[model samples]
Target: MKDESLIFGTRAIIEAITANKSIDKLFIQKGLQGELSRELMSLVKKNNITFTYVPVEKLNRLTRNNHQGVVAYISPIDFYDLENLVMNVIESGKTPLFLILDQLSDVRNFGAIIRTAECTGVDGIIIQKKGGAPVNADTIKTSAGAVFKIPICKVDHIKDAMFYLQGSGIQVVAATEKAESTIYDTNLTIPSAIIMGSEGKGISPSVLKLVDQSAKLPMYGDIASLNVSVACGVILYEAIRQRL
Candidate 1:
């Protein structure tokens, strides 16, 4: 992470929050107590921002400057409003195609998924606010600048987005190896959202329950699972093929 992507010092961080800066994460020194810290905590709670209390050494490791036991990582790109984007897509008389990522932590994988989403004409990509990969320089480079071409929405949880998409009459599909059905058999030629999970865990059970359908890629080789980005590409392009 570069200094440009970080907001250091207590007051500076508070100001950033007040100004509505897209902070990816916040780190505060453990056991720090003061009026400023209290105000910061109030703001963080009011905004529902993700934060962690870390040792002073951890803060020092982030920046050598006088950070006043506070540092916030800023998101490189602005996040889109999921509801408005969905409405806009519907009003445009086009079937909405969205990609929802559940706790995907790898930056390169996220970037690659974004690139594929752009190529497949996906309307937007949704990710959980806390666990998803940050849109930073590395992600931008990995996507070959495709990140800028796509709309990314960060929500508090993936399940909520899944429900909203379902309520809107859009089919929500999950890509998991545990599924008995294959992606080719699923009807992806309508308003749909494909939910891909983290590299380690396929998909959270809670989220999987909310999906309209679960589909998996057929595997003939030795590997039980494919890389997350590769799986996403395979499924998304499958949707594209059906639509065409």
Candidate 2:
């Protein structure tokens, strides 16, 4: 999609990546053949950047400029390396607290989670590189600038991050309606990472199997579930409460 955060043209994208710019997504026109396009593909592959090849009509919809078969959305904030962030948090002697999102798609929900995480003293927030919302203008607006204040890491896979966090002695807790224990009963006084799922499907089953524990929020009303962001806020505040 074309926006203030987007940069089109094969050469421009290559240069942006070379400059260490955080590209949220890249779109290439299908059957786009050119020397520069080849170079762009090579660079994208080498860097493990996510890209999609779309039809020319899709390219046209992305931007009216000379796209040269490539367009990318530049992230508003730089992403943190998960390993380094976790290491630093441990070394700092503060009880590690992290929030993880499993394929949460809505930009507004993503923003609200970030705001809540920031307010709750979460050390960082993690989301997958693909199948999740980007740190775009809408997200920034919804976050009210909290997106810039928090450390966010984009991981290749949610399960991998869970494994790493568990290895690092941080417990991975999942929030799901299926859980028997409510958040108040869950242990959050230790180093922990709480995962909130997508708006539609909740956490993927594969990812859920990797978590050390799963808990749900108490619901007195007839509604079966709360919104993802609202659930995240409740879970985060509970963690903060236990720590206090």
Evaluate all candidate structures by whole-model CA lDDT and list the values in order. Answer: 0.92, 0.91
TM-score (all chains, Cα) for each model: 0.97, 0.98
Write model 2 residue lDDT over 16-122, tens digit each, in one string: 99998998999988898878888888989988999988888887887787888888889989999999999999999999999999999999999988888888889
| Runs with alpha carbons beyond 4 Å of true place in candidate 2 | none
Candidate 1, clashing residue pairs? none
Cα lDDT over the full model 1: 0.92
Best by lDDT: 1
Instruction: Tell me how many clashing residue pairs each candidate has.
Output: 0, 0
**Model 2: which ten-residue window has the lowest total lDDT?**
1-10
| Candidate 1 local lDDT, residue 65 | 92
Residue 35's lDDT within candidate 2 is 85
Instruction: Itemize residue pairs with steric clashes in candidate 2.
Output: none
